[model samples]
Target: MQTEASPLVDKFQLTEDHDSVFPKGVPWVRYHGKYNDLSINIVCPGKDSSLGVDSVGTVSVSLLTYASVQALHPDIIINAGTAGGFKAKGACIGDVFLVSNVAFHDRRIPIPVFDLYGVGSRQAFYTPNLAKELNLKVGKLSTGDSLDMSPVDEAAILANDASVKDMEGAAVAYVADLLKVPAIFLKAVTDIIDGDKPTAEEFLQNLAAVCLALDQTVTQVVDFIVGKSFSEL
Candidate 1:
């Protein structure tokens, strides 16, 4: 149970009223069991990326991130979800990664002045020591609005040194950066990029199992955060 005085409780006290900001069915949970002092909020923006009301994309994620910051003013923001791993990078289905950095793979600005921003890289908020402590793989993640990735796109992503691809990590990270809030991402591999089957098909096939794995992994992360000293956090 959470007390009214708890920072975590205070942060999310009004989240129930703004359910529209999050994924359609996923609800936000405020945990006070182990880390009552730390304010934490978890959200899952839906899978749709279009401009529709329930869409999921940079725009949607950016809005969610902004609203979350204004509402929570949290010490850290973490985006945990599923992603497609690249086989060429030794990634396999069911593997979980602690993203060290994130960038956009689909954003290709023709103009030279905007190219760097299109391909810009942002570091994860967690320290390398924390990743080692969690025993999770540290890798770069490429993000885009779409789940489907062609072979040519995979090649380009590999060239950029991204080991995993997700639909929302970079957008969340970018917003967190703009707000000067630390952010970290955790992704469980639900499919192999460029595999024999289509990425979407493979993801659907493995979604359930991957989601279970992600649940366990996220529990471990919460435990780690709760056990850490305030200075360490």
Candidate 2:
């Protein structure tokens, strides 16, 4: 289980995370630059080392500016985050997931007219085939501003083969589609949204990923990249 280290530390052997399993000086380089040809430039919601909320307007401006700077017309852009699980079944407190689709958990289109079918709306999202080959668990990921704890919210997420829920996924999809790129997503299932569940050991960081979750995710992405070494299809 590991949180991410800087690319230089993780890739170029510059340093290591405190809990890194690697023997000192043995240099476990987990992040190889050739990430399915992503040429990825990650821009988390932040200014420096801190996780800036960068909500709404800030998120838009930052992403646009970063994308422009990287000259990245990405084939895939992923918005990975830690999320509270409405139903963390077949999941642990820190299970990592591949989110193939995300919905607005709080969305409801009211029908003003009795005769008119209120167009209930949500987005259908998919990762490139790469996600399937990564062998990570994939499912519907619902998003909303407030932590969705209502019975309706539980039912909405449970209405599918969903694993978890979050906030930023829908926005990421909107932006990536606008840029003509596939926006992918993942969530490290953090806490059960249920109030009665055993209090989680302040084990997982609030915004940063759950340790085991991030490790598994990185492993999957690494396998995806390594397989491309020969498959190149």
| Model 2 Cα lDDT, one tens digit per residue, 7-78 | 222443333234433334322222223444345444433232244323322244335434543453444555
TM-score, cand. 2: 0.61
Residue 171 local lDDT, model 2: 59
> Each candidate: what lDDT?
0.71, 0.51
Model 1 pairs in collision: 48-56, 49-56
- Candidate 2: pairs in clash: none
- TM-scores, all candidates, are 0.79, 0.61
Alpha carbon deviation, residue 86, candidate 1 (Å): 0.8
Best by lDDT: 1
Q: Whole-model lDDT, candidate 1? A: 0.71
